[model samples]
Target: MLLSVFSCNSEPSIQDQMVDNPGDDGQNENPDEGEELSYKEKAFATYEMIQQLYKKGDLYKENFPEQNGDREYSYLWPYVGMLTAGNVLYELGYDREILDKQFTGLEEYYDNRDYLPTYQAYPVSGGATDHYYDDSAIVAMELINAYELTNESFYLERAKTVTDFIMSGEDSRMGGGLYWFEGQSDNCTNGPNCMKAANTSAYAAYVTSKMYQLTNNEAYLTFAKRVYEWTYTTLRDPSDNLYWNDINIGSEQINTTKWTYNAAMMIMSAVNLYEISDDQEYLDEAVTTARSAHSKFTKVTNGRIFYPPNDSWFNVELLTAYIQLSQYDSKTKDYVEVFKDNMDYAWENARNNEGQFYEDWSGNNEGRFYWLLHQAALVEAFGRIAIYENQ
Candidate 1:
């Protein structure tokens, strides 16, 4: 579902790139200015195009007539796509009728049998079940966003329910981090075993921080700190300040891959903690990681920033966190151009004839099949960029 972000192991000398919002002197703001398509327009175009993936208002596995036939993969990712893509549509000020269709698709993901949402569900039926803490946490965070968007209690209660389920996946394992899966999952040696993944735990921390803000619940804050510190201490790559992918508590195995989302969500969580606690240290941590990760992950193309193509769904956390960090850290504002340029390049070069962008924005792997998650990721990316431009 996710990938390990590959980066050179060698750490370069990192500077404190904290920003203070420079005053204009001809080197002003806005990167995608005067383009044929406004950033919002491009986002809206992609938003409308992605709705075609939904089947009877719900998206299932892509069942091309030749490839998988009509059989749905029934995986959890399409829901992630829907939640992300739906939020982008809302942020773009799309019509409520268009947004409601997405809302219904998202609503279709919940499993009502036990009043507990699971990972995978049939498209229309919304039944059949498996639970992944990471998957539900992704939904839990979006449920709060939906609650914000709709001002509805149903979304709020569901957010709380999903958060409760995420909590159930936690134990005092591996110096105190949450488990990756609720039970036995595919591709694991032992059945029903849990892996302490950095992305999952850090994302849960981020979600709990939001929940704390939502309810003013000290318990959520306490848990957030527990998860945050545990992730920070356990998975952080001290060499470069980036983060590792996962750790096997039983064997003490550490997957040293430096993933973007794991660090991005941690940065976002740190920003939230700083805002709530008024702690400068958290802000410093957020800014430092944002600066260092941006340098480590991006390459220059015709002097424009280019991100990795394999798993862009993870990039949403980075883009969203960057938008959040830029508001507080002036240093992060400079990177907005990098974000915008990537979007512009993706639109010009990576998009398919069908309007779906491949996961690989580099276009070297254009043959890779189209995925809703990839399109959803860019929708969120462009949506975040739209937010920055509006700000």
Candidate 2:
């Protein structure tokens, strides 16, 4: 019983854009000045938030609530929110006890036997007709992360189940991208053209590379390479180095509207492909895309990336891209530092007094849970950077 709270049509209040000071000069303010906070401090803060939301056997109750005689659970947003939080915990060196608890809650919701409407108001609600390809793929990515942290075959097995379902023979038309929902006979006949489709493919590629690293499985490597080729060739805008959000397979027109997350996914996919293959082409693609995105969206003021116009989720994704590229190319140090500066800016300017981020720093609040999920990802990215610096 998932409640469908469809607030997508409403515009965000003007207060959402109310920042205290947009002209603050924090870039030259000394990186070591801010309380000397370690990654552990940030990770623990995020972990405590998770624990407060999910405790005892009452985790499912929070996920599926019955308020005012009506079921009040959003299908996709809550699930993705939990998955993002779980990944942050995993990256912060949390134990399997927490992982098991989170995984159990996700599995229960996904495994519900009752039938419901497929196209509910919720974005990722699952039902007889609903086939949430991207949301399910995100869950798979989280499971894969859990497997990496816990060495648990169960997590890997669950991830494989999700992959198999999406990769089934039903999705042969859209060049391997996942559909948003089921039974669309129009432009989405093959699948939804959302950027999440590309993101899912990229996640699969990354997971496959990791699996190959662990098992030396040539099959996984081959699959990874194939998916990488498809995504880069199809979704990538070679001219602008940015990716479109959707593609109309029927009209053959690329969804020219660019998004920060799509660019981040392209960066991640290119980096993983380069690592697995050690091919200069892949590395060049990654570098080219990163530099292009930086030039287009980021400006350096006081030696820091300043006032980037995009979503907060891209802040973390861009950081991860910078870190990965820096491993192969030391010249990315300057860019990586810029990324850190931008992240600090986000912490100061984007977050509300309640420590929550709006959907878009540019003042678009669709009321989706993706903004919160992005905040969790930022915590994970910072934690990883902290660990790397310490090492």
Candidate 3:
């Protein structure tokens, strides 16, 4: 079973652990001082940093420079980055032991409470946390990637389980979109009530479409197109072709906040649909959205391109979309290069003494504490960029 993974450690303590070859400041060594590291090298360095700081046994903690003695494991959202990074590392030909260990770590977050077992936001050891559909969808998508790479039935079975739960959130209230959270209120159709978010809806489409590709199941593709059409029609902004955050189902007012990942997920949905259906229109839609997203979110800094500021993981999602789109549209190659330059610059400038990445990729602001998700984001980005460059 997915739940039978790793045993919890007896109270994690930073003082109790030992790291090899530490610097004077008790951090891992960077590549000399001024020497620029390759994308793979940078990825490896950051992965080591993650292990040194965030890891408690096979599972990862929520933050680095441990805040409390509680040693809280990372929430399902942030741990998605780690799962993504592990998949990327598997692509880069990392050891099977390393990849399997990360998979074992993820089993810690699996929750099998009701009929459809899914990964909860926080581990069961930390008490009950809300199960977000988007979180489980993202993890399932990564598991799909793992299945594609390794041909593992375990990965596929777990992915199908989480995706089954994700599909359970879909309804006809907002014209067939998945709710952001698992359970809905009594009158979700009235007043200022629950939201049907682009992230949840579009990712549900992306996951189901990929599942169709893997299994050749018509049911997956049917749900994929249903949710994709709903999200595209409901949340998309006609003005810029970028996506809004979500639609408040009760008030029927759209949240106009444009997040990088929201648009990226839609792009992914289009790409998956095109690949599955062999439809030129879906390909065109993906290309158009990729162009708009690159223009909307990226900016030129100094001599190179920089990704969107803050929410580093959002940019990582965008990068993933660009890498996938680059196969069809050569223009997205330039978009991927922009992310490459930005990650390289961040490695040189935005890192703390302990080699932890600050949320700011521009290197202008100094962050006192680094987030585990931010570091995991960069590790995934670097590994992904390295794979793209090699291709």
Candidate 4:
């Protein structure tokens, strides 16, 4: 895995190895400078891309034509993508029509859940052939967001059902942490089983916290705290802000070296926890992690913040972390500036002159769905940053 290969050896502290050139030398350069648009500008560009990609009545395609066989559809990817995108639109002062359509489509899918096949992809082909924890978690978040925006009890009930499905696992490695799929054999050895993915766990925690906020239910809060503890104790790297991608179920050592998205999830979880608890520890951890990630994976080089390893998706994840951390700690100008620089670099380099974006700087096409999803996530991050700045 990329994490294992990249983070094999321990490195210097992020403070000591901080990236030079956060902006022009000595001078405070505006984060939104030439060759890169501001966060709001980039968000508007992404919105235009979404408008161009989907037809008025057509369902969102999970992957582009190059990947996933021309135009394959996914039961959950489009819904999740639209959820993120719709949140961005709402922040941008767009009408509710777009969100309404996205939610209506999602509701139809959940209402007719039987038609969706289980484990349609490889690597995770064994499970219960029904709902998986990861998919259900995403569905739960989308439904909760729907309820938050619409004040609908139906959306709340649906979110609860999805959360309950995810919380129902019993296998040793599977129960404490959410599983990738239901009915996965006890003996199955896969990446998902080997690694307790921070993204899935964090999303589960985030949704649980939100549910608690809406209903004042202690159960949701308790579940969020439990997941947060598991994540912090098992997956986090205390010496540095970076997090391990996964953990060995039995040994409980860091399994996957580290990944950008995992760090992003950790930051988001910390933010959510801080909001609920008013605990400075969570906020401090979020700032530390974001700084560490920014110093190591992303650096300001040649007047731009770029991922040295050249995975553009990391840019998006790091941007999300920076925006989330900045909301609580406005003093983190360096981190926020790096985030804006990286976002600008990504928009400038990733997009073709004609406006299409490659999956990443590496130009791999196998994971277009992952790329698109992260793109939408970055857009949402920008919108959130806008809201924070205004507040």
Candidate 5:
């Protein structure tokens, strides 16, 4: 059993909690005018580097014997990094075989017998039992994207199965929202860290909404609508009107703060709801939240970065949502440039000499390696921006 701590698209970005981007990542102050890499070039380069992290064999680490060195000491969310790249490739229609290989490797994260994804999986042991809901929700979301891109039943079916896993995490315990952990039984605890989190519920709302659109299942639609409603009612901070990170199950108190991914998930869910129902309210909600998230992060350090997650990995969801919102509504256009500027900062400053985004875009590069999700998130962000520009 390989154990490690790393932040991800939806997780705490590993050992560090989502916080300020810190000091100064100089790129914002000195936006590079003569950058060598274009968005497309950065996307391709980062995309390829993330794929290289996938090795076929395992090894051992003396420090962490419990952890699988065989995985090259990598984690699960990085696999989602690969999926993000695959989804981008699929949307751009440039890669089929690579995406397929990504899907197969991603499947390694699933407990085939259980038909659901593990929180973190390795080459031999496969994955975990009690899982984080947000992690599985991301897998489901990517599968649906893959399914749409390829019209593959297997992707859709897997998406639905993972949806089942997400749904199982929901309960009325926290005044109605999905719990952060699922698959707890036989003395198991899925959410030992935090019982319910805003991030999990938000993504839960997103994947369910997308599944509703894909299968035309009213049950999914109802669940999607209900989950979205539940999250808003339960997690929305009444004072500032921005979202908080989670509810403290011990006290049943809302953790009165925000994270970029939380807002991103809500943005995507609301936009999707608008797509299916043509409801102006959903669109409006999405725009409002998008603007709020942008405001929270942009005002931080001179509009330099729109996400302050200690690890910029989670910024992927927020950036994609911002781009999607901009595509869907003109009111969100201004935020698009903010995201572009941030990406520019990342490309100019965060990427190492080897050309992969490390942890945080604060211009202080810590060469720890093993940040596949970190790099791929930026790749997906750039790829989506490129696609948006072409249109």
Candidate 6:
């Protein structure tokens, strides 16, 4: 039986959160001036830049020029993205001290609300923030990856704890899919307004499947299959073979807008189910989604393959799914190579003066404020490719 780490309630020191980058001038630099850095080195450089610019103690700021002065710390989503990159680099033998330091920062958001412990979207320092099921699910997935790479029981235990929180979001609503937000009284009662998003429920299924892989727990496997089926049946768009954004359980209205991460989670969840169940149908579904997502989300810009502008973190998730399925489908390898080329192009063209990435990967748009997750996404992308090339 695994126990969760006790939650800390003490206020963080003001002095600790006030650490800002002193030398940052916030100007664009010549891309050619950089010495030829490997993908791994570039990843390291980007990760270090995140620490320098965004690290307010252990947590990060939401934006480069923060939207709000008082609320300086980032929400759970960006922090999760930063940790996602850290875990990726850690797998490639990055600095253990730095990796552990960044990961430990998760404690800031750890909330034990009435003994139903899980992470909230905002740091606990600001009081109890909204607990999004998707945020906790992603955090658990990252922790699971950390545990797999290091064989650390602590990461695994924390992942299980978060998984418990994720499972709490699942109710009989929508014929059985997890609600997007926790503690919402209208989650089940509010017709047409209750959102059980693909991002939340699909990712929860992926995390559950991974937990099953780590523990061989039949209960986890049962939950994974059920949730995966619910998400697929509820959110997938038949025309494109990709997933829709979410569904309104009350009205049964599906949001047809497509996002890269939505389909990517379905692909990954399908792959996990296929491996665990040895089902050809699951593998076939994974392959079909992989091809469809690759064609839909990416395009050729100036002879380089590029992701859609903005949402770097979403593309990172999509790229991860592609890599996971590449073992069975050789075409996925080609998909990743194109993304690698795009990263190289962004390195040369899309960087700002502070070495942070712009929302636009096409190098056409340069902005004043760089997002924390955008920068973190680059590190994750490069680190993944470096790991893949080595393998």
Predicted model with the maximum lDDT: 6
Q: How many residue pairs clash in each candidate?
A: 3, 1, 0, 1, 12, 3
Model 4 pairs in collision = 128-182
| lDDT by residue (tens digit), candidate 2, 81-194 | 556566655566666465666666565446432432112224223332244444555566677777777787987876666655544312445676543433341234332232
Clashing pairs in 3: none
Tens-place lDDT per residue, model 1, 25-86, is: 22112233346877677777676676665343345444211142234443455457667667
Query: With candidate 3 superimposed using the best TM-score fit, by how many Å does residue 66's alpha carbon deviate from the native?
Result: 3.8
lDDT, residue 225, model 4 = 81
Off by over 4 Å in 2: 1-36, 50-71, 112-129, 169-176, 182-197, 214-219, 299-304, 307-310, 348-350, 358-371
Q: Candidates ranked by lDDT, best first? A: 6, 3, 1, 5, 4, 2
lDDT of each: 0.67, 0.53, 0.76, 0.56, 0.65, 0.77
Worst 10 residues of 6 by lDDT: 1-10
Q: List, residue by residue over 34-69, the lDDT tens digit for candidate 3.
A: 876788877877888888888887788766665444
TM-score of each: 0.84, 0.72, 0.88, 0.74, 0.82, 0.89
> 196 in model 5: Cα distance from truth in Å?
2.1
- Tell me model 3's lDDT, rounded to 2 decimals: 0.76
> Candidate 5, overall lDDT?
0.65
**Candidate No. with top TM-score:** 6
What's the lDDT of the predicted structure labeled candidate 1?
0.67
The C-alpha stretches of model 3 lying farther than 4 A from their native spots are: 1-32, 67-71, 185-193, 367-369
Prediction 1 TM-score vs. true: 0.84
- Model 5: how far residue 314 lies from native, Å: 2.0
